[model samples]
Target: MIRLALVSNKLQKIQLKVFDSSTFSILRCWDPHLSSSRSSSQNLHDPTTHFHNEEALNPTELLNAQITSGELNEDKHQKMVVEELEKVHQNLQHYEPAKSTMFTRLFGRRDVMDSPKGIYLYGAVGGGKTMLMDLFYACCKMPRKRRVHFHSFMLDVHTRIHELKKTISRNQTSKPQPFDVIRPIAEDISNQSWLICFDEFQVTDIADAMILKRLFTELFSCGVVVIATSNRHPDDLYKNGLQRSNFVPFIKVLKDHCDVVSLDSGIDYRTRSSVGKDRIYFVKSETEADREMDKIFKMLCSMENDIIRPKTLTIRGRNVTFKKTCGQVIDTTFEELCARPLGASDYLQLSQAFHTIMIRDVPVLSLKLRSETRRFITLIDTLYDNRVRVVISAETPTKELFLSEGHDSGHDDHRMLMDDLNITAGSENASSNIFTGEEEIFAFDRTVSRLTEMQTEDYWKQWDKKR
Candidate 1:
């Protein structure tokens, strides 16, 4: 029962439970705000003293401390988010509700109580939404709590549905409706976790959209609370999809259950983080380029030792190998990725696994290497659709990446390829043309747009482990 005491000039005397390390990071700053009227000899054995001095500061002062110390750059909106999150932290810290068993309820001895209302924090890219959520999740004292990417959570749900279908197949009962499976799934989830934190919560799949309302209803009934972060507000979720009206109830359910907080900090922190950093570099010397790319990989990986590791991704029974990987970042060569025969499915699998990709030494695409260029187009399309971050070292700039140098012998100018496809070079509809025979040239405009956007901090913020 470790306790944390928060002292402010105007707040009630609130004592909170110290559940996890996040509480320590958030509370250590509160030392400076110690009320001056208090006695100096209070016999308090504070556990957080090892990290910070006896002095405590309020949330704003704590944020200011980070800015002054150069640990974090100051953002006014991010500070406001931190302040709001502090209240949530306090609520969660003091949250202590008795568990209700089925026997207790059935015997007419149940106590009526309400669970803590969760928050939905949504905002533009790089607004520090995920960062604040991480702080909240780290300190939340709930014994049964889970933090998962929304796509991965849905993947698990679909996988469970398949398994449930198998069980029903083996049984002698009549066929169960698809909705019938929701109860068992929701019950399983609620039994395991009373609190769920979802990152990048959006509904793109029709199956997911259909099940959310019923599934969440069961979860809420079982006292499960949800905390989520997303780019869209509750009403804007599942926007413009097939049978979207069927998904409307879930929006209402979400609104009814959670308080929506918009972290409209207007600052692109990710882009700010990337300023002057060479995410994409044009190099004349291959050796110099490789060395620089290696350095970037090490920096992004945050590796103390300069040991590069090999990582393998098994896609469709074929194993693809990467030379360097740490956390959600992967470093590989363009030759290994584009030169080899890989399709959209492989790139889609790669996108789901890695958030940031550092590809080195991308040679300018010409008609001679048409197959590789086409594969590269597909790779970029998949990556862009998934909002994965891309860093590259290339012989040419992004605008010149797909311009044909010549045919196989490097003698024939390849503008004729576009002419043969009857797509003019500067045509207004060129970006939307998909039948140029040369796939790379057909998709070049949009691919270039996505590649350029990927280098921005806003793009980095929209990045998700899954679409």
Candidate 2:
């Protein structure tokens, strides 16, 4: 009889809740090994005991138990994924090799062993791929393991390459080829993590697409195993891009190195969950709006209450402070963001720091508020591009957030806000229109369209991905 129990990190015993198997619909999760009774001699403080308790549970059994306990929605496809992940975990456990290091290379050289094949799980948004990956990552006992979002990982890769190039140039050593920097970066990753799990493994950026083949080839050579989850299949990654033909080999390498698995249980759990949740709010009173936003913030933060704290981000030597943040969920005022002279870089930095953002008091973007409106447009575009989740309390609905000032009062058409802007469905011309003499208004139109989409359950699905 496995009953769900929770133990506080402070070593306090918590009451166990048992649900009748017939009526197990409401669910929560904790370590299943926790029992209502413990012997006086049991060493609750032992780290080894905690580690063993985690290992006692299998991914499939744990997930099934979670479902049975009403902690998760039961889905056959998700259970199948648990089985696949279990295999990968077992393979990793059985894999035998000394940790890759310079010390081993010099003093204790050993033959390179074949690394275990990893899985590439692909599916529609909110199908529980991330949930399974989280389970797998938690169950992995390997000391050399790392799980990172693909976007952040690529950013690190690019940053490291830049630093390496600067070093090479400053030292006046041998001229390094453009491809030469990838080896050390991959080697460093291999040395640090034998098992690498990437969330939302996308390759839309041309810079990333160009170097992935060489980079991953080196990674594989150095014996790093990878598990990644994505909405796109390996063959379909970077579907149609500039110089896409050159990026095809990397897809083959990915296919050969990993088992591509798809999980679509024909239901989006997030969408189902979002049935009664409000994503976009139109509020006239700032006080009520702030209170509602705070409630949502607390809900997203969950039981890790202390994790909610302010974060200061340094964007190109400028210090920007977010008033409230819990893990990757952030809360800040629209005035704090748009009133400043921040640009795309600042918003991009914010996107990297937080996956979900709650912006309070978004006023109508009239022509008089041109600078703030421009900044707001830039911020939203960056957030949309990075797939960040945006929750807002605005003075009006999204469609009406931007309006002509005094157009009804017979102001000049050119003086009207909408007259100066010519926006369309999907174009980048909106940012330049007001001052750059560009006719395209699609940037703001697309921004408005994105605002609508972001409010949907589909866009919220991607919010689960790490920032």
Most TM-score-accurate candidate: 2
Estimate the lDDT of model 2: 0.65
Per residue, candidate 2 scores C-alpha lDDT tens digits across 1-467 of: 11222335342221212223211211121121332332222110121222355545667766765666555777889888888888888888878545567765455333568888899999876577766886777677778898876766887888889998888888876765554788778778787887898876876566888999999997887778899988777887866544567889999899888999999876655434432134345465534776657666654454333477788899867788877787777878889899988765678788877767889889887655666877886787568657677778988877778765432222343335434455332334223233332211223554565576566543544433222
Top-lDDT structure, candidate number: 2
RMSD of each: 14.8, 11.5
Per-model C-alpha lDDT, please? 0.62, 0.65
**Candidate 1 C-alpha error for residue 95, in Å:** 3.1
RMSD of 2: 11.5
TM-score of each prediction: 0.55, 0.60
